[model samples]
Target: MASHRRIRSRSTKPSPAVGFTTAALAGVTLLSGQSASAAPGEPSPSIEEVQKKVDDLYRQAGSATQEYNKAKEAATEQRREVDTLLDQAATRADRLNESRRALGTFAAAQYRTGAVAPTAALMFAESPQAYFDQTRLMDRMTDQQQQAVADYEAQRAEAAEQRAEAGERLEELSASQEALRTSKQNVQAKLAEARSLLSRLTAEEKARLEAIEREKAEEARRKAEEKARAEAERAEAERQAAQKAEAACAPETARETAQPPAQDADPGSGTADGGHAAKADKVIDFARAQIGKPYVWGATGPSSYDCSGLTQAAWKAAGVDLPRTTWDQVEVGTRVATQDLLPGDLVFFYDDISHVGIYIGEGMMIHAPKPGANVREESVYSMPIHGSVRPA
Candidate 1:
C-alpha cells in the first residue's frame, strides 16, 4: 500500500489539515453548536466555520457512499451465487426424486414377486455387501436396479449438501443486504446534514464560499504547474546525464553500446504501450463527457455518478472493468507517485481513500465532487493526496 502524502497548494504557508480528525471534530461542533438556531444576542457560525462543517459532512458522505457501493457490489455477487446454488440444489432435488421413484418401483416389483424387498433385505442384513453375498441378490438383481440404488444414495447426499450450501449463501446475502442498508442510511444522513449547513448560510455567505473555492482552485493550479515544471526539468537533467555518460565512454565501448544487444523479441510487446495509451484516451473521453452530470450517491451513470462510479464507468468504456468504490479502485492498476500522475490516472484522496478523480494533467481532475454538486474539473491538490494509479 502507498502511504498518504500531503500536497499543499502553497508550501510556504500553513494549510489547514483536512484529515479525518479535523472533520470529525467539525462534525461534532456542527451538531452541538448554536449556529443552527442562534438567539438574537448569540452570534451564528462564521462562513469559514460553516464551510469546514459542510466540507466535513460532504467528506463523511463520500466515505459512506463508498461503503454503500462496496456493500452493493458484494450483495449483487452474493445474490448471483445464492441463485446459482439454489438452482443447483433444485436440480439435484429433482434427480433425487427420480431416483426415489425408481427405488419405489423396484420395491413394488419385488413385493409382488414374493421376493425380499430391498429395504427389508438391507435392514435384516449386517451390510449390503454381506446381504448380496449370502442371498446372491447382486446376481439376481438387474444391472438397472443396482445402478438405481447407487444413484439414489449419491443424489440424496449431493442434494442435501447443495441445499446446505445454498442456505449459507442466503445468509451471506442477508448480511450484505444489511450492510448495504446501513451504508445507505449513513450516506443519506451525512448528506442531509451537509444540506442543512449550507442552507443556514445567507446568500452573501454562499457567494463568499464559492469565491473561496475558486481561489483555492487557482492556488492548486499554480502549484501543479510548478510541480510539472520541476518534473520536466528533472527528466531533462537525467537524460542529459545519460547522454554525457555515453559520450564519455571509450570509442569501442560506445560502439558496442550504440549497437543494441540481440534478444528474442516478444510478439505482442510492440503494441502494449500503444494499447494502454489508447485505452487511457477512451477513459478520459468518457469521463469528460460526464462532466456536468449530477453526483448521485450510488449512481453508475447515464445521467449521474458518484466518485468511484464515474471512474469505474469511464474505465469500462475503455474495456477495463474496475472494482466499485475507491477502496477497491485504489488497488487496481500500477501505483504511481503523485508527481508522476498522467491524464486518465486515478488520483485518490484522503487517508481512507474514500474519494477518487481522473487526472487530466496539470493537477486538474474531473470528478463528481459531492451530493448536490455536479461533476466538474477541480484541482487534485484541493484535498490531501493518497497517491495515484494508472488503470491502463
Candidate 2:
C-alpha cells in the first residue's frame, strides 16, 4: 500500500511555450462568461468543461516551463563559449602586438646602423653571389624579420576569426534569452487565465469541481494498482520458468561434464542489477527528502524546484546527471513500459513530455507538480503517461 502523505490544495497554474490554439481561445471565451449566477435562458458552462480547460491550461504551462528551462540552459552554455572565444581572441591580439613590436625594433636597429637598402647592395655587387655574401640582407631578413611578419599576419587573422565566432555566439545567446522571456510570459498568461476561470466559480461549482478531481484521482489510482499487480505476477512467472529450465538441465550437464558447474556469482560483486538498485535507492532517498519544497520554475536547488529540476537533482544525488529539461532527460536511459516501472525510475507525462516524476512503487511518483504546488507524492496515472525510463 502507498503511504499516506499530505497533498496540498492550491491554485492550479502553468506557463506556456507555444501560443494557445483556437480551442484554447474558445475555452477562454467560455470561461470568461462564467459567474456564480447566470441569467434565465442562458447556458452556463458545465463544471466538467471548466475543469478540463483548467487542466489543459496547466498542461500547456508545463510545456512552456520546459521550453523556458531549455532556453535558459542554452543561453548559459553559449555565454560560456563566448567567454572562451573572447579570451582566445585577447591572447592572439597580444601575440600579434608582440610580433609587430619585434619588427619595429628590427627596422629601428637597421636605420641606426646605416644599413644599405637591398636594392642598393644588389646594384653595387660584382656578382649575384657577391651581393648575397656582402650584405646577407635577404638571408637575414628571411630568418628573423620575415618569420616575425608571418607570425603577425597569422595572429591578426586568428584573432579576427575568434572575435567573429564570439560575436555569432553572442547573437545566439541573445536569441535564447529572448526565447526564455517569451516562454516565461506565455506561462504567466496561461496561469492567469486558469486562475481567473477558477475564481469565477460559485461555492457550489467549486465543490463540484473538487469532487470531480477526487473521483478522477481515485480511478487513476485503482488502475495503477491493477497494473502493478499484473506486472508483478508476470515477473514471478518468468522467474519460475527460468528456474525450472535450469533444474531440468542439471542432470544432463552433470552426466556430460567432468567437473561440477561453478557456484552462483556473488550478489555483492557489483552486478548491473545490484548497482542499479543501489543507485535507485539513493535517488529515491534524495527525492523523499525534497518533499514540501516549493515549485519554482527553472529552479534546481535545495530549497525549491520545477518538475525536471527535481528529477535532475535527485538523479544527480545518485551520481547520474540528467539534462536540464524534460525533453532531454527523456532521451537518456533505457525506455521502460509503465507497468514495469520500479522505484526511482523516471516516468514522463503528457503528450508533449513536459512533466516527469520519480516512480516510487505502487504507481506513486514524487514530483514538483506546478507553480503553486509543492514537491509531493501522487499516483503516476494521475496524468497521461508518455513513457517511463530506467536511469541507472
> Highest lDDT among the candidates is held by which one?
2
Candidate 1 at residue 356, lDDT?
A: 94
Pairs of residues clashing in candidate 2: 15-61, 15-187, 16-186, 16-187, 17-64
Instruction: Give model 2's clash tally.
Output: 5
Judge candidate 1 against the unseen true structure and give its global Cα lDDT, from 0 to 1. 0.76
True lDDT of residue 379, candidate 2 = 74
lDDT for residue 192 in candidate 1, whole number 0-100: 70
Stretches of candidate 1 off by over 4 Å are: 1-36, 39-43, 115-138, 142-146, 231-275
What lDDT score belongs to each candidate, Candidate 1 first? 0.76, 0.78
Which numbered prediction scores highest in TM-score against the true structure?
Answer: 2
- The regions of model 2 sitting more than 4 angstroms off are 1-43, 114-142, 231-270
Give the per-residue lDDT digits (tens) of candidate 1, residues 1-392. Answer: 01111232434444331222222332444444534555689788887787778777778888999889989999999999998998888888888999999999887866664486767977888988887685565446556788899999999989888888888988999999999999999988987776666656655776677667666656776776677566556556767887887678868675778688757578676575566667877887898899778878899998999899999999999999999889988989899998777667899998888899998765668888776567877678878888899988
Cα displacement (angstroms), candidate 1, residue 298, comes to: 1.1
- Cα lDDT tens digits, model 2, 1-392, are 11111122222332111111212332444446644455689887798888888888988999999999989999999999988988888888889899999889777766754577778867877988988675676558547977887888988888888888888999999999999899999898988878677766776776677667667766776765676566566666767887899899999888868877767689466366667777878998999999888888889998999999999999999999989999999999999988667778999988999999998766678898876667887778788899989888
List the pairs of residues colliding in candidate 1. none
Per-prediction TM-score: 0.76, 0.79
